[model samples]
Target: MTADLGHGVPEPATTAATGGRPEGHLGAAGPAPQVVLNLARPWGEADPLDLAGAALGAGLDGVTLADSPRLFPDCLLETGRILANTGARLAGPCVLSLGLRHPATVAGALGTLAAHHPGRLLAVVGRGESSVRNEGLAVPSLRTHRESLDRLRELLDDRAPELRLLGAASGPRTIRATAARLGGVLVDVGADPAVLGKAVRLVRAERPEAEIWVFLRAVLTRTAAEADAAGRPVLGSCASRLVRAPDWYDLPAELLPRVEAVAAAHDYRRHGTPAARGGAGRSPETERLVRDRFLLTGDERRIAGQLAAVRGLGVDGVVLAGALTGVVERLNKLATAVRAGLAIDPAVRTGPAADPAAGPAVRHRPDRRGRNLSAESEE
Candidate 1:
């Protein structure tokens, strides 16, 4: 599917070449970076399960649902529906927060899901977001977060031995603690390569083998106005969650007030709407900071460059938050960008090409000399 990302930007040619496999391996790149969707607006106009199936169809690795019970749909129910509706082998959805819910309740829900779907169910818990705040509950302390994760992990083993427990970490203590305990750590710190690089180092320092996934606000366009409009809501909300502790970023003085303003003005009650979360982004400067250091918003090559930079830092995957609106097209556009270890992509086409599924026109593997020789030329 050739999706026009407005501005006449077509879907990445890599999407066609990989035959829509999210794990499209570019040789010697370790493995393709896992591209997953984290629904910033889970209960929006789109059906969550249909969105999950569409994501799987468009070469995405996984889907994670928002578990803000008071604010939206029941993530456990939605996750199970996706498992049942979508092809089990190709996908599963993670519940984004068990921080607010009791570990026993979470265990029971997941156990029931496992009994029905078995290996297709997945869970990732975090110190809750809207799920906590919207209900007037205090954000769990780091120690409380650690305890909740441990109990959930233990309970899941009895009911669903195959279930993997991944925890989310946005700060130093949580990053260290989650790494020591969970199967993987969803690093939701920031999208900046530098921050992610530091986060990657921190995760590995605690547990070398931990799976590290960074959560990013991703946009597949280069228009400054469009990117700002699309990015502000999500990024502002993220700032509110992550920018509280000044030391978390060691943020500069100039950027400090801007980020702090965004954090302060973001309202979860009006979550995921441009109007509600338009904080410091009223100016180009704040938006640029977000684009450069906190979010992904640019043309395919620029986006690819950022992805490559992050991948170079040894990140395992990326969760595209606030992506449910145009999930499939955006992911397809990002397929080539998600590649690792290589600076230039062989699959990137300069002009129109035939559909790769047609069997003749396709991307060729890079040779040992690192040359991308086409099949037509190699023979």
Candidate 2:
């Protein structure tokens, strides 16, 4: 049973609380869709040991090791080992910067794991930000990123290991390209229902068979008030991330300034601010629009409603960003609520979570521009 993306496209409904069919295409009798749990940020100093414990306890399906090189060097291998040891689902760490430099290297690292793990890896990609830049690398444009991803797939040689590499894109062009080249697109930029609908429509127009997932900040609070309070930072954090780099998500150029403003105000170091990185402020109009469009704060039922709204728009799955508490506890709580509400079985694990090509399909065209670019991505 394919889920209707509220637009004309049909998606598969799932029993899992994370909700959705598999990341791959859903045939008439395809198996269940896997719910991907992304662990992009550190849950406030929560140790990896504790994080694993919480995930195992909550019954998550998978985990995505983040893009921070300093934070996730051997950490990826360690996390993979832990998840495998615990009998939990394991997705690739899939740090995006590596792909920016060497798509083959990214594939090799993950491909080696897929070969070993066999059926437990899901590869996710993202637009590297300050972290990527900090490493002396420039963020790849959507076009370049898509092309690189296609190259990585070519390098894979259809191994069909337990892995599926997904591209992170929200812009129309990227979405269309993703539908053209890769397995799916995970919209990690804007959580707005309208934006989601637009993305799905753009992708569906081309690859009607592509998968679309929404990554949202979620809190299953004790009450609506608590949920709202917890939700503020999640909203601000997203705004901060997007406002700084609107192009990453293919946001409308007009709305970019607005997002940047709100992000500036919501400093991670400041009290009541979401724990996000980047510089601060913008014009009043830009701030207001960013506040209204990107910030999503509310209760669980409300969050679920917001999620439903997004679902109605076009998302295949909701990678709920759990509350910002200590890592272990928060992951535990998130896994419980999201899994329960989405009807996910206790047995499933939530692993981490993202493109394309064109006419004549000129493959592996040496990127003259990127060749000179060091690993450090420009902002």
Candidate 3:
């Protein structure tokens, strides 16, 4: 079926002709020099302004505004203002897809955000049963999904801004559509490099210029014991998510049972036998699995190594998965390590900002490339 992803949305003309390495190909240039981090306020407890400030303090690249729009409506707009005030890059709705069915609503929301943040805004779209259920909406079918993307593209063109639309989609069809129509696709989960490679190829094939990015979870430990112990709860789930490769070594062995359980729960039993446990993000076992698979735990080297693996997998950058309480600190440590590895400048603070509520007064901070800083650094 021909889905009507937004019209006038420019499609990448040719992947081969595009001036970059293929997805999963981290060349001498190294992985894309962008990192995204999460800064969420706990349900009913997070202040968007506070979260934004912390991200700036830690010199984070991006601050993804989480749930509780009631607490911070037009969160992107507010975040853009904060980023402008501080010079921190921004990205989000990391879990928001409520307006996917209504292109007008999407346009209006994005229009407001662009008006406030202009080039600072990134329109991320996705679908999740949990998110849709929470919003009292029905989960959309794949066909509808394609249509939604089309509508979003149309809306984006109507908005008339230079900002990019970042799609948080990974399934094959969604990835293909994203490549064909949008500026970039945010691969937030999954661990199969081959799968990601294929997704990249699809995008590159249709639109070589389309940016391919991967979001990864990492946790480092000083020793195997700490890594194992800290990773115990989520080990199985993490292992299950990993599409095994000879070159990668961070997958844990202790969490096999949880992995099996998670695999079974997701109908991904082709990977291995089902464990005695059951389900995806439920139960203590499942919760642990989720933690292990989605978090990077260990020392700096270990963490950096895991990220390196991600780079080898053809990912452009990693959008950090972190908890609210320690996210800023984690981001700081991660940014430092990754920057050192990539040989990028280490000073990435959202500079000279005392507060988020203050009106934006942005300054131009160019990268070593002499180009304006890219929003890709914003998670």
Candidate 4:
């Protein structure tokens, strides 16, 4: 049963919330999509143990820490604390930039962690966006980036087969390249069912064996009022992340001007913050449109609908990232609100909240040079 989603994309209606693999794809029908938390900042700088407990209580499958070495505490150290404290089967650096550490050293560290915990370690690699840029270094070209991950994959496999390797891609070329080189892809494409479906198809087309995950800035609240109260950061995320992939999903014709303004004003340097202003017009209309497209806010019903829409697209999982404030609170809220609503069942016993690619995720962003970068990217 196929349903048209108005954007020339079709979704498999029967698959909604079933966690079933999409048909006609080459990848193994793995477990249902997982819900993992990739910490942008320590849930208001909360203790890692408390955060791990929050994840467990929320029925989360995994947890990942953002790996900006200088801006925050060591992600691996935080990961160790989470692993030691919680029963979570997935945890690690959401993205460890290749520029900061040699793949061999990283592989060694994660491999060691996997040896102690086993099947619980996962690694994501990117061009080292904020971290590298902070040091006044240039990000790696796609070729060098992929080659480095390829080596990381080789070393990881030799040390711990259970460990999974993923990449953060900024466009379709990177998505395709990531699908070919790594275990999975972390995408920031739009959360529309059609867009999710398209991303799934694109990754499987390149490497049916690969897994996929969506990176979203979400906070599922108990009330609309609560959501709106703390939604500024989420709205900010829309401007920053979505603006990067402006073409990933179609904006209403009425909102194009505001979106363009957002693109023009997007702050590439502070791209990860909830306060990042990617240039969206200040009008309530623009904020609403951007909010509805990129964020998961409001009450439980709204959160469920969005997660269902994402899983409906046959995605294997979602990575929830948000502001430093109330992150733990939101994760706990997701356990109750999202778990109850979506019936999220993470099959991962050890690794893979699992993914690492997409249709021009996929908002196929236009770089400074105006070349379309296709991805649900980070950075």
Candidate 5:
């Protein structure tokens, strides 16, 4: 699939490549970055399918399920259930740790999901954390990650899943491998513009046509204090990754110790939870610094500005890690921010903006069997 590099903004090629028409494809539709909801289960109290339905209803681009079986439900099973029920395209089970499942097993499960939801599923694999850490397994090296991805790709060759397999990469080596071998690279770092831009440039340099997706922690608050409060818990997840590899991010020297503190105190059992107070030791001043630097936060207007800045960096899409509480409400706010951000460019925000309370129009495509797979009926 060709990367949409027009206007210096990256756009998803899946719709064009798969012969499906999503709301905003390349060309006149404008480069509206695909907004994928990260439905990492067990974090939220609501049912996963219900969240998927609500997100799709809100007109978000797609949904990604976490692949941590011990902490969350089975990703493949939940994905099939979501596809069977909603029109939203699926992008996970992301970060499938090579240490837990063999390449063949992972490929078989992915093949089955794609076969059932052809043209609407994307597989993202990586050397995962939390999932493997909790089980006492070592996270695979970059070499293992690349080799596993290669083996999985070869395994699905004849089966014809007809889907793109993306690699979740952050470091230089893994990013280059993803560009050369996989369908694309999903940047695993939190939403830091500098880091994201560097990652995008590296992948684009290696393969100009490769798709780039970024994962960001999302929080909406009226004040900086509220932003810090809402963002502290989510930062735990980021700190966990950063602590393991300090050189991975371009962090300020003053904040390095805080990050290390969070990493040293991290508990796998509380991974991705609001209760995960890895940042407890951080000074209030330091916590605020981390929040301002790493998270996508602020009121609607501020968030709009931040997202517009992200779009300027040229990412194909952004996957938001949902807030711990009021998941649906936060998603609606995010959708609003995205719409508001697009409005920054009059040419990009076309048509009436979607109402946060009402369901947005979701387009559907036929599976191999020629059956319509949309949430709404066709005329």
Candidate 6:
């Protein structure tokens, strides 16, 4: 049966109780932002079922399947299989490029998945990195991406209102589009505190209620070397993006040329591999800088401090990605650190809690940008 898409669903409110805190302040009263595991690294190296089970065992709130078919398995099928086998919510296919599939086709698929998963599914679409470059396709312009999302939302609202649509954004324009039109913005750049803080403020100014999510590479290790090695690919990816769109992020002035060099030199064929050569490969210092600036690394205490700092920025949630080697162990360590971080928040108080299994609900309303607005559901 088709679900009514026009009815206003009462999505959970972005109150201080849930992770969505008020602008400019961390809301300790709410549960920690949901920690999602990105299974991009394990897509081909590990079985999807095993990864899903590991994610559930690690107590991750959800799992995101990367949508690079050439580099990984089919995300849709893998996600469906995982959803069938485990209770871990599916967070995304995080479409790497646009124009490959018609928006309606993507919308229909997501709507069907939402119908099956209900509140457990979140649809994250964006101009992803490696997949497009590998295909020799041009990244869709910001305007085209926004329009695609707008069309996708319309289709989903007409067919399945319960399915929430979010855009992956890094710059001012995409952030504005997400605040104005989509359900939320998944900030997909390095976890630089300044960049994150600025993005959150930008979205809030446009739409105070829009959900804000940040993605970061996380590893729990005793030494900086181990952490840097584990996070290099992700860090390099961030540097590549910075180089391609220098104005998109607020990176330090001195680092721009180096970052641009990395982009210019990045070899897409060796994507996500440790040996993947890039201009950033010029020196160990560049690698270390990218790792420190882009990732959450070090021991539990240090990682906890970093997570807390991000939460303090009023972020709604965080998506953690890591290397394929010992992926489950890393996820377990990160989850433990997240719990510790949440425990330390001053705003957290002992009280009757909301359903722990329930995922964030999103609803849309008309906004000034002539786009649809999405917020945490009060349900």
Write down the lDDT of every candidate, Cα atoms only: 0.58, 0.49, 0.47, 0.60, 0.63, 0.62
Query: lDDT by residue for model 6 over 1-379, one digit each (tens)?
Result: 1212212323222443322322222322244566677776524576756766676677766677777766777777776676666656444575534546678788778888877766567667877657777688887776677678778777877777645456787767777776777647788767677676677767766665566677777677777667655754555576776765566565677888776665565566556656555543476667667667677777878888887657565455667774433345666777888767645453432211122243232322323234544532221
List clashing residue pairs in candidate 1: none
Model 3, 1-379: lDDT tens digits are: 1212122323112233212222322222333445656543334444555555555455445556543342224545555555455444445555446433366776677777667654445456666433354355666765676567667777667674344566776555556555555656776544444444555555445444455566555544455454434433323434444433212323456645544555445321111112212444645554454554456666677556555445543334456554322334455576666555444222321112323353322322111111111221111
Report RMSD (Å) for each prediction in the order shown. 12.4, 10.9, 14.1, 11.6, 11.6, 9.1
The list of candidate 5 runs beyond 4 A from truth reads 1-23, 26-30, 244-248, 323-327, 342-379
Q: Sort by TM-score, best first: what order?
A: 6, 5, 1, 4, 2, 3
Candidate 3 lDDT score at position 223: 57
Name the better of 3 and 5 by lDDT. 5
Residue pairs of candidate 5 with colliding backbone atoms: none
TM-scores, all models, native as reference: 0.76, 0.66, 0.62, 0.72, 0.80, 0.80
Cα lDDT for residue 243, candidate 6? 68
Greater TM-score among 2 and 3 belongs to 2
Off by over 4 Å in 2: 1-33, 41-44, 72-75, 98-100, 221-237, 240-258, 263-292, 310-316, 322-328, 340-379
Candidate with top TM-score is 6
Give the runs in model 4 whose Cα sits over 4 Å from its true position.
1-31, 42-44, 134-137, 221-245, 251-257, 263-275, 278-284, 322-327, 344-379
For TM-score, candidate 1 versus 5, the one ahead is 5
Cα lDDT tens digits, model 4, 1-379, are: 1211122222222242222223322112343556777766523455555565566556676678777765556888888777766666577887788878888998888888878765566567787666776576887877778678778877877887656567876466677777776747887664566655556666766665466777765666566555554545445545544555556565455666776565455354454554555443466566666666666776666776667655444455667774533556656665566555444333322112123222212211111112112443443
Q: For residues 1-379, what per-residue lDDT tens digits would candidate 2 score against the true structure?
A: 1111122212223333221223332211122233445454443544444454455456655555555654343435655564455444545554455434577777677777777665556666655543454455676776577668667766765554225556666455655665566655666656566565666656545554455566655544464445334544444556665655566456688876666555555533332224442334435455435444554444345544554455333234555443343323455555544544444222232111112122111112111112221122222
What lDDT tens digits, residue by residue, belong to model 5 across residues 1-379? 1111122222333555434425454311345566777776563455777777667666776688777777777777877777676666554676676668898998888888777767667677887767788687887776677678777767877575356567887666677776666646788766676676677767656665556677777667766666656664456666755655556676656667876676666566655556655545656665665566567776778778887656654455667776443445766777878656744331322111222343322222213222111221121
Worst 10 residues of 3 by lDDT: 365-374
